[model samples]
Structures are given as C-alpha cells and as structure tokens.
Target: MNRRLSFSLILAAALSACARQPQLDDPVARGQRDFQGLGCIKCHQIGGEGHAWGPDLTLVGFRKQPAWLDLWLKNPHAWNAKTIMPNFNLRDDTRADLVAYLSAQKGQAWTVYPWRTAQAKALPSVERGKLIFNMAGCVACHGQDGFGGYPNNNVVGGLIPSLTNVSDGYGRADLHAKIQYGQISSPADPSKPKPLIYMPKWGDQLKPDEIDAVGDYLFSLKPKPAPGSAAASDDF
Candidate 1:
C-alpha cells in the first residue's frame, strides 16, 4: 500500500510539471515578443521572416551602436526630418525589451538596395517591386504585404488607416499624389477632416521608378476573385 501511494504521488507530480505553463522569464524571449508585438516586423525582418521595407535587422547590432539605436528607436524624427519610421511611443520597459531584442540580432548579411545600382531593364518586375515595397518603408505604415492596421489603428489610436486593398479605395492619381507629396488629410474621405496623423511623402527617400515599383506592388495586393486562393495574411 505504501509503495502504491508513493508511485501515485510521483505520477501526479510529473503530470503537474508537464501541465504547467512555460515561464516567460527570459529577457531575450520577452524582447522578441515585444519586437513582434510592437509591429517591428511590419517594417524590419529578423531571420528573413519580416517584410524588406526597412533595413534587414538580422545583423543591425553589428553595424549600429546600441546607444544610437536606442535613441533612434525612441524618436526617429529627432534625427531625420525625412525619416519614414514612426514613433512607437513604447513604454520604458517595453522599449528596453525591444532594444535588448534588436541589439541581439546579428550574423546576417545586409540586403542590397536595388535603386542604388543601375537598372539594366526598361520595366520593373513584380518581384523587384515586392522587395522595394518593404525596403522603402511602405510596410512601416502599411502592414506587412500592405494589409494595414498592423499594430491596429485602434491599438495605435486610429493614427493609421488600413491598406488591405488601398488600390481599390484610392484612384491611381490620388494614390500617386499621396505617395509623392505627403498628405495630412484622409485620402479616403477628404471631407472627414484631417487627422493628426498623416502619410509622409516619399519624394525625398524614393526615386521615381522605385515609387512606381512600390505602387505596382500595392495595387497587386487587391483581393483575389477566390478568397481561398489568396495567400495567408500576416497578422504580425
């Protein structure tokens, strides 16, 4: 009877240990989660999973100083007026975690900027356009794959509008104007009054052809005739 009781107790303890939730005590894990939760992946890639809109951050730590990254992440506009990156308004703890995570990213090669090199072809390819869409920081505002509301406008206080199928919403000319010349007012409904947030112009950052390529990619994000046939969208 004693042996049976001891065996039963051991079994119960083993089961309890197996059922317990995994601890999230590790800072690196927390940082990675914060990186994703804060919508960093919308613009930057780690391990090639995220969009290419921003610099490939796999090895950013190796290139930039930690102090600089912290300051830049805090407020990019302070450094550059033409920067496309948005202020995340991160909590101290959250910012620390994100910094910890980003600082740890290393060992990956940087991706080449397509426009920096001479173009050998007359027309841009969709594949190249897709790459430019991310590298150009369009994903910073528009979600990965231009889905929009990445961190969710509600989560971010309605500062951003959705881009799920922006081509359908805005005409080519209107979209072109908004992309080339930043707009403070709502492109969807100009009569609705301007919001505090707005889209920045890419005139300074992007070459005309680069803008055209990114524009093509955005237009291609239009919903397919068969929803089931479309690729799964990234909620990150």
Candidate 2:
C-alpha cells in the first residue's frame, strides 16, 4: 500500500508539470496566445477587435515588411522616441513568434475591413480617398493628410517627404502612376543598409477609381496662396 501511494503521487506531479508547460508546437499559435496574454489587445486592434488606442493591425502584413516589424517589436523607442508604445523586453524567440502571427494578418480573416464598408463607399470621392488613406495604413508613414514627418533610415532628409505640395511637382497622371508603381527610396549613404520604409505598390491592391480618388485628395491638400498674392502668381 505504501509503494502504491508513492507511485500515484509521482504520476500526479508529472501531470502537473506537463500542464504548466506552454504548448509551442506551432509558433503562430504561441505568438497569438502571447499577443492576447501580454495585454497587446489593450492598445492595438486586429480585425475589429480590441481597443483603438493604437493603429489597427488588420493589414499590417501587407503594409510593413517582416524585418521592420521584427525590429519595431524589439524596441519601438529605438525607432521612434516619441512613440507611446512601451517596450515589453520580449525575448528573441518570442519576438519572432509574434512577428509570425502578425505577418499572418493580411486582412482576409474578416469579410470586409472598415475602409471598404458601405458607409465609407457612400462618401464623396475625396472623402472616401481620405478614409482609404487612413484605413489602408498610408497614415502610418505619411502622417495625417500627408503631413509626413516619419523617419526612414538611410533616406535623404532622414524623413518621409510630405505630400502637401505634391501638386507643385506631379500632374494627376503622374501622381496616379507613382501611387500604382510605388518607388524605392535610395539610401543617402550607399554604404548603409537600404531604407526599411519604402512605399509598397498598391496597383494590385487598390482599384483604378480608388487610385484616382487618392490623387484627388492629395491635390486638394496643395497649399492655397492668398488671392492675388505673389505665390498665387507663381502658379502660372
């Protein structure tokens, strides 16, 4: 009887240990569990869930490169000192797992994202363009209304160019082409790594009409000079 009781106790202890171990068979699954367990939901939203305090991550996979995302997760402050996101001091493996999970969020899980909703579609072209700009994650790098002060490593000026004066340089057709094909920002110093924040091509992703609407919205932001002013005369 004494031997039997000792054996039973040992078995129970083994089972308890097994229960304590996290099932990490799948990295994406583990990452998802960590995403929820680590309170990321408190600040970031995914697929219409969680708080809106941070940028919606539904289309992050499409908008950002995996390497950039990994670096950002490791230390957000290193990239943006003013960013409100806190450092979790996550381990390398944990960060990789999280990246895997986040990279899987390509906006297909939901039937329709907020930007493609009926209400959004009903808005005027310029208004709808504004909505697409924000919801499609252009605002992540360009800032609101293309104010554009975001940093890009190895890029000229050390910041993304603002679109407030795009009209000065680009015609409607030219702007549309730029948006469709996108462009790689060359490094200021050839010796350094390429800029991680180059624009992504939207031709395959956005419709032709949507592209035109974005151009309209951008042109509308052109700084209007005072009537009959010197700046106004330069428009000719």
Candidate 3:
C-alpha cells in the first residue's frame, strides 16, 4: 500500500514538472522567461507587471530603435555618462532573447493599482505612505521608498529626482506644489523647462486632501536615528 502511494506521488510530481515547462518554439515566450530570469522585473515593467522604476516598456518597440536597445542593454553608461543602470553581464543569446521580448512590447496602459481608490485619505502612518506609494503607482519611478534615481528607459536624457530626504529642505507647501503640479524644476530657467514633467500631476488624479496624504507620506521618509545616537541631538 505504501509503495502504491509513493508511486502515485511520483507520478503527480512528474506531471506537475511537465505542466510547468515553457513552450520552446515560441521566441516571445522564451524571451519573457529569459527577461524574468535576468531580474529585469526588478526595475522594469512589461505589460503592466514588474517594477516601474524604469519607463514603462509596454510601448518600447514603438519608442526605441531595436539597434539602440541592443547597445543600451549591453552597456547603459555608454549612452549616458551618469545613468544609474547596471550591466547584467548577459551572454549574447540571452541578450538577444531579452531584446526580442522587450521589442514585442507595444502600447498598453499601466495596470491600475488595486488599492488606488482605497487610499483616498491620509493615514498618519509611514506604513500607509508606503502603501500609497505603490498603490498610487508612484513606486514605478520613485521606488517603494521614495528614493528616485533609477534610469528611465523611455526618456533617454531626462533627470529623475530622489524623494527620500526631500523634507530636509522643502516645507509642506513646497511638497504640495511639487507633488500636485510636478514643479521640481525652476520655471525661471528656460534651460531647464520644468524638467520634462515625467511625473503625472497628482492634483488631477487625486483629491487635494489625498495629495496631502501622499505629501505627508513622502515627507516622513527621513531616517530617524536610534536612541542615544549623536545625530539625534537637536543642536549642531
């Protein structure tokens, strides 16, 4: 009886393994698998899945040249001297498959975060800020912690600012302006031109109070020193 049960378990495991196997004939499927394996999902979004630290690659094929992409993927620093993108050290075959997968991505709307509607009010918790950051789709560029230095795939020569220590200088009003209007850049400087406005205007998307909640959340990201730490002293 024990032997029969063991055989049944073995058969189930074998079937499961077969079911998990990807289709080898499909280049798209192979490419998707390779993309995930290379940890591209850590900072990129394809078809509304994965992280949003980089540009939405859903329409990458439409925006970027395949040749440019091949070179960019191999070494991002070659194109942008200050780009934070890292080389994956991928082999030729893997890079080819990954590029094929990225090139197949076409115009698709970003996935609406599940908790967007639920986050209408500002809750006084850093944890809530973290949730709104992701649910509001802020994590795609600013990251889950509000630190935003990730290389953008769509905007080749744009600047992405970090929000981790924003509260150190900017007051709540400044935060309100920046968050609701995407006003990080100075309008006085024509050379800057308000920084290409990569971030969407939260004023249109969220209510004033809701925007305030997000602002509060962003302002709270300053690291608190441990008890008895010298940095914790109020005096300089």
Candidate 4:
C-alpha cells in the first residue's frame, strides 16, 4: 500500500512539472490577452485605449525581464508596499505569453544599461547627485537622498513610491528619462502633466552634460539603511 501511494505521488509530481512548461507557441500573446482580460487595461493603458492611469506600457518590453514581470504580475504588493498596481494571479501559461508579447515591443536594453565597454564606464553618480538633488529643489518635495518626503500640502500622492528604494523600480534608461524629462514617458496630454506634483519640463533647462551628470547622479543615489530594517545594507 505504501509503495502504491509513493508511485501515485511520483506520477503527480511528474505531471505538475510537465504542466509548468509551455508547448511554446510564443506564449506572449496569450499573456497579452491575460493582461487585457484580467482588466489591467482599466487603469494602465497598454496598446493605446486604456490610456495612462499608469505609465505607458508602449515600451515596457524594453524595460523589464520576463521572469521579473511574471513574478510581479503574480504579486506586486509583496515587492513594493506602495504600488497602486494590482496583482493578477495570472495562470503560468498566459504569463509566459505576456512576457513574450512585451519582449517583442521592448527597446534596446543595452542602450539604457550598457554593461560593457568604454561607453559602459559611464555609470551614474550617487555622490554628486545628492548635491544636485538639493540644488534643484527636488528636496522641496522628494526630500533629501531623493527618498520622497512626507506629502505636506495635498502634494504627496498616496500611491507614489518612496525613493528610499527606487533603484528597484526602474532601469538605467528609465532613470535617464526621468532626469531628462521629469516625467515618465511623455504624458499623453501635455496640458495636464502631473506625474509628481507640478513637475516642470526640465528637459530644456538642463544641458547635455548636466543632464547626463544629474541623471547619473540620481541613478547613483543608493538608499542608506531603510527605516528600521535590521538587514545589513545591500552592497549592490
């Protein structure tokens, strides 16, 4: 009887493993459907229509990894305590398909995070960026270290992320865009751009090198030790 039970369990385990793997018809489209059917489009616009309650996903594929997105879609609250995005426990098959779809629309990953060579040496600066943070009056709202301060005057949006740990949300390219534009993916309606409290279009104000310098600096600011978390600071 024990042997029969063990055999049954082994078969079940084998079947589960097989189920996890896709037959591989580019599961991305299936995932895209899941993205839509699951009602993500209601707030976060994807191929247009849904518009932009969230960042434009037009080029999201260029930004995140499949495995990362898959995990995120499954559970966002687990990662960031403040994200307004909802977690959709999408089936594994649909999730794989979504990753594939996004990948298809993705921009050049290396351009944003060139991991090799001479140009690659141009990593953003955390030290110099601190000075820029205060000088630019980013401290008025985002607070020192760019951690995003308390919303004193109806200014702080409840769902906004705390910069105390921002490096995790965006890629190097995403950082570049924020520092250059002060907004995420140019707003659909320029007349009503309020990504974060009346962010003035600084694209024209900052110069080529300063933009690079400031952006690199902003991207470089690593969070000190988060409030009371006893874990040793993450090295990277």
Candidate 5:
C-alpha cells in the first residue's frame, strides 16, 4: 500500500512540473508571453492595441532587420543613451524570442494602414510628404521635421544626421537617390560592431511620386538664413 502511495505522489509531482513549464519549443509563443509579462505594451503599440507613448510598432518588422531588433532588445541604452526605453536585462534566449515575435508584426492586420491612405495621395506634394514622413516612421529616427539628434551605436558623432542641412550638400536628384537606395552608416570605429540603425530602402515600399513628395518635405526643413548673411548668399 505504501509503494502505491509513493507512486501516486511521484506522478502528481511530475504532472505539476510539466504544467509549470512553458512551451519552450515555440519562440514566438514565448515572446508573446514576455511581451505581456514584461510590460512592453505599456509603452509601445502594436496594431493599435497598446499605449502610444512610444513609436507604434505595427510595422517594425518591415522597417527593422531581425539582427538590429535583437541587439536593440538586449540593450536599448547601449544603442541610444538618451532613449526612454528601459533595459530589461533580458537573457539571450528571451531577447531572441522577443525579436521573433516583434519581427512577425509586419502590419498586415490593418486593412487601412497609413501607407495606403488615399487622402494622402490627394494632398499637395509637400503636405503628403509630411504625412508620409511621420506615418512611415521617419520621425522615429530623424526627429520631427528632420531636426535629428537620435543616438546610434558606433555611428560618427554618435547621432543620426539631421536633415535640416541636407540641401547644402545634396541636390534634389541626390536626395531622391539616397532615399530610394537607402544608406548604411559606416561605424565610427571599424574594429567595433556596425551601427544598429540604417536607412531602409523605401523604393520597394513607396511609390515614385511619394518619394518625390518626401524630398519636397525634407527640402522645406532647411532653415532660412538671416538677410545678407553669407549663408543666405550661398543659398542663392
């Protein structure tokens, strides 16, 4: 009788242990658990579900590569010191799982997403560009009106370049080419890891006219110099 009781107890404990263990085989499932349990929803919104305190992550998969996402999740401050995002000190496996989950969020759930807005197409070129800049997540890195000061890992000056002075260096054609082809920032230290942030190619995502409109919006951001100043004369 005692042997049977011992066996029953062992069986019960085994079952309890199995119940407590999460499904470790599926990273995406584990990631979803982490997303909720870790309070990521408090700051970021996905598919208009969470709070809007941070940049909307509905299309993060489309904008960011998996490697970049993994690194960012592991240590946000390492990439951007001034970022409001707190580092959770996540384990390697946990960070990978979260990256998998976030990477799956490519904005397909929304029937009327920002990039497909018909109203934007009808607006003036400059106005449409402004809308696209914000909606396409340019504001996240470049800052509002392209007055950029965002930090990037191993990047020169440790911050993304501001677009306010782009016209000084790049003509309309050059600007268009940069936007369409995208740019990979060279690391400040060639020995160190590359910068986490890069310009994603918009050519595949945005129409030709939309790209032109974005150029117009960016050109408009150039600051007007005071009259008779050398900068003013240079602009002429």
Candidate 6:
C-alpha cells in the first residue's frame, strides 16, 4: 500500500502562461475523452463533477509541478499505492497531450485573479496586511519580516530568499503573476527539467482584495538602515 516513488523524481522547471495566447490542440480533447474513458471522473473531478476521493482538480495546474503531474499520471501507485486511484501506464505520446489539456485551464473565469492589470492598484493597507501575514502561517516560513525562512525542513532545507529583495528581481506585474501562480526554478537547480518546489495557489484561498493587500505588503518590504541610523529621511 505504500505509494511512495522509488527512484526519486529528481525533477526541476520555469513559469509562464504565454501572454500571447493559448493554443487549443485537438489532442487535448482526446486527452479529455480518454480521461473519461479511463474512469478518472469516478474519483477525481475536473471542471465537471465527480466523486471526491481526491482533492478538487479545480486549480490543480497551479498547485502541482508540471513534471510531478507527468509522473503522477504515469504512476500514482508507485508514489502512493494506498491511493484509491489506479495507476495507468500511459504512452508518452498520449500523456503529453493529456497533460497539455488538463494544465491549460482556469478553474472559473472572472475570479478577480492577481494577473488582471486593472485590479493591481487596489493594494492592501500595510498595517492590516502585516497581521494577515502572521495569521496565515506565512511568518512561519517567510519569517516575521518576510525576509526568509526554512524551505526543506527535512534534510537541511533550502534557503528561502527575502521578500524585501524581490522588487529588484521582477516587475509589479511579474511579481503578482508569480505570486498567484507560483515560482518555477532558479540558478541553484538548473539541470532538472521541471520546477523544483511549488507554492500553493492562493487564487481561491484569498479574496481579490486580500490578494491586492498582500501584493502591496510584499511590494513594500524595503530594507532598513544598516543597524544604526536614527535620523534617516523618509524620501532619502
């Protein structure tokens, strides 16, 4: 019944939804129908209804790593046999299209997601936003000041970089997009083919406004003076 994977996935990846446009491949429909034929609908639900033996697939693409999805599809049993879901040894050709189909969906339209350009301006009040950070168990990981925290927690974990430094890394839009979706990978782990770790999708867990506030809070973490500067100007 142990469903853990044997040869570690050793997977790693980047982030993108292709701002140009998403192409609709005929293979996706094939994957969808096959998904139904395989009786995946019996235990798992996508946009349609199905028994709830598994977590809702409403936003799975944003939750899991793509490589993980590919591996999970090939052998869920290898990772967790106790899983009620059966393992389907699918062909690589077929699995590719199947993944494309499933990964290309947004749970529901008009959810006031973080990616919308118009809504980006409604950032939260920094005061209330600070406490939300603490309440959401964020301080536990990103640290009390959103600087950084333990990532692996297993063997020696990875170093989580400080949020205070992200503004220098990407744009406001890029930051929001990354936050809503998730990070891909970094220079530290380049050889692997899929994303290393994933951040849970908060598109649902957070209200649109809360998303804005957290966005504001994150966008605002500036560096403090080096230990001893009592008379610094707010603008300087």
The candidate that wins on lDDT is 2
- Which residue ranges in model 1 land beyond 4 Å of their true spot? 1-112, 118-124, 151-159, 185-197, 227-236
Report lDDT per candidate: 0.64, 0.86, 0.66, 0.55, 0.84, 0.58
Clashes of each: 4, 0, 2, 7, 0, 9
* Residue 190 Cα positional deviation in candidate 5, in Å, after optimal superposition: 2.7
Ranking 3 against 5 by TM-score, winner: 5
Tens-place lDDT digits, model 6, residues 1-236: 23344223322111233332234457766776777777877876665467656554645565555676687788877644445667678999678777866676445522433233343434336654564454333453466678875342111235556788766787867766766665544534454433334466565556655655666777679775664566454545
Against the true structure, what is every candidate's RMSD?
16.3, 6.7, 9.8, 19.1, 7.9, 16.9
TM-score of 2: 0.83
TM-score of 6: 0.43
lDDT by residue (169-230, candidate 1, tens digit) is 78867776778887554334555533433455666556676666667767887877755444
Show the lowest summed lDDT stretch of 10 residues, model 4.
107-116
lDDT, model 3: 0.66
The TM-scores of all predictions, comma-separated, are: 0.44, 0.83, 0.45, 0.38, 0.76, 0.43
TM-score, candidate 5, is: 0.76
Residue-level lDDT of model 3, residues 1-236, one tens digit each, is 69999999999999999888977676667888987887788887765689977655665654344676788878878756766779877788777877887777654343543334445333454555565566555765576587776454344344456787888878988888877886333343454424322555566555666666777788788888897788876674
Q: Which is the winner by TM-score between candidate 3 and candidate 6?
A: 3
**Model 2: per-residue lDDT, tens digit, 74-119?**
9999998878899999999999999988988887756786657888
- The TM-score leader among the candidates is 2
Checking candidate 1 for backbone clashes, the offending pairs are 52-134, 52-135, 53-134, 53-135
Model 2 RMSD, rounded to 1 decimal: 6.7
Clashes of 2: 0
